[model samples]
Target: MSLPDALAASILSDRQLRPEFEAICDCGGRLAGTPSERRALGLVARLGEAATGQPAMRIPTPYEGWSAQEAALHLLGDDEEVELACYPLLRSVPTPPRGIEAEVVAVGRGTEAEFAALAPELAGRIALVRHEYMFAAGHLHRRLKYEWAKRAGAVGFLIAGPLPTRAVAGSSGRGHEDGIPALGISPEAAARLARTATGHARARIRIATEERPETTETILFDVPGGGPEIVVLSAHIDGHDPAESAIDNASGVAVMLAVARALAPHAGQFRRSLRVAIFSAEEWALTGSRIYLDTLPADERGRMALNVNLDSVAGSPNLTALCSGFPRVAELVEAATREAGIPVGTFLPLMANSDHANFAAHGIPALRLVAGFDDPASHCRHVLTAADTRDKVAETELRAAAIAAAAVTWRALTSTDSLR
Candidate 1:
């Protein structure tokens, strides 16, 4: 058998894939700067060393940290007040003890034109927007909606979750800077706050949070090849506090681990070194990878040939490489998948939604492998909701992702042409 086929077979047969994924899920939602994140990082350190035969290096990363103590939302009416379920978006600035009461305006889907049309009505009011399926094409990010609300002079922001009963969760994209209060609510809560005949509906939002300086670490494993050029294989270890963050990223980390195990032994035969970067705090605006890359010298960054980032790789049977505006990288991925007898799709846009964007901004060709792209029915919709658990990922799906990842990494490691 050919060497790539032999490596793919080894990865498919490796018994640690599912176990490692479940173990990460078992560690609870690995919220950055939390105990849960620490536990998962420790587990990954051991497993990564075992897989790559290299001790994991913990690169210290410091950043502003935030934790929500309490967040409450209530609808105000003439005679009765109704309380609604809500979760605070990460890094949301806390309101006063009594909270801010303001008129609530619903902007449909939070499109730019919608916000523009409602510009006059948004000022001094709380803007409400809908959260769409994230893995689909043309979908808007919550951070963009939040930023629109803030720029429109809105007092606060509310994102109605896509799920029926569960409240969504994600970063507010605001660091330690001044920002409006933000929260995620269920669809039912959004329905109740519709425009009434009398005037815009009024709601009260109270959020209490604490902020401090914190430090975390990004793990790295370097498996040197025969050449100076490097191929970076990366995945984020951090996720939301809701559920297990399974379909969003545990699948990616697991697939990465399995591929590393199967391919590290053959690095000496390849043309590029394989650098495994497992990052934390990715949920907080991709901070982990950004910090790691920013700290490197320009000469060191120039040595990087490509970055193949695995994220949300197995929520569905389908996989697509978000090639970060590099069409040649997409072609390479397609060829690798074809060689392995697996079908993988490609998208030719630069998505700042994952760690790969950090590498792309540095002029390195970077791509993010994701599952269920444009497939709303896929379990990836459950990400950031309470329903995102280990059960949402299937063993076969994870193995398929690992096989494809191994093939791609192997091809990238041995290819003589410039990846960029």
Candidate 2:
């Protein structure tokens, strides 16, 4: 059956999505194991019950939890010292209680070859690199740069953001044992840390954090249909520790909740059941989704027809479905959106940047709907920073994404061809 126009219209009202979005935003950045993340789980469960007519099930998932208490970076010049604005990378190790001092070295973009060129004199020095535009192609991830610097024997790491005065935020993909003291610094800081006529300058970094095994909950709602097959509409509920995390994910969760409410009426008539998997700790390298998917048995995993992941879906008005190189998935989305009178774009290459990659890795067809695919100047540039707040997205843009998502999900579940 085709998606009813009435159902589409029902989701248009901002009354539901806006408050839900704000509530999630008010919960702070929702970093894993934080009070904010815990509050979000309860709020989402209430929203899920209102949408699905049944209480959402909380699935306990375990992961290593990391949180920062305080972090500071300063450039120690011969005569005058200046403090730099910065944010610590997730899971970074703390420096000595008093901090560590070392000579600073700039490795440009910190690519493999860049590190190789400076390999001769990198030991015991602090490596400085630049963060790239996340939504663009060929953009080097911050983790790769940290690994390269670690291999080159750097004692500490610093990454500069694209925007000046705003220190870029990202994960070092490091643990207390495997990582050096890593922090994200502003471009201005990078400039000051540059070598002067007096040669390389010294820097000091101090960090205080707590690390241990912790458990977070994954909220799940299963609306059963006649068949055994399932279509998973998924999104990550947690985001960076800074800002409202609006563009990075509050937008996605808001869209998912609205869509879930729209589809609940047609629960058993569709060709397949809809399973809502609202996950957490996505900013921590997709840990929540990975653990949940890994727990499914072979037979249950095979029952998963598709995973439609919504993440960072409203930083811009334009939306693109990253289909991970699956031509059939792209075709399905295009046809559905066209049928709905919405012109949504599609990118065929597979990107492991979000939770969808976990599903696709398990051999299930998965695609991530995102905004500002290659547009660098879009509001997505604010993601992972303090600027990813509620104002970055518009109600119209979110409604458009919901329409596109609903159209594609309806087509995927009701199509007779049996999605490849």
Among all candidates shown, the one with the greatest TM-score: 1
lDDT of 1: 0.91
Model 2, residue 196: distance off in Å is 2.4
CA lDDT, every model vs. true structure: 0.91, 0.87
Measured with C-alpha atoms, the lDDT of residue 320 in candidate 2 is 89
User: Model 2 residue 195 lDDT?
Assistant: 90
Q: What TM-score goes with each of the models?
A: 0.98, 0.96
Instruction: In model 1, state the lDDT of residue 240.
Output: 84
* Model 2 residue 219 CA deviation in Å: 0.7
Clashes of 1: 0
Model 1 scores worst on lDDT over the 10 consecutive residues at 1-10
For candidate 2, the lDDT comes to 0.87
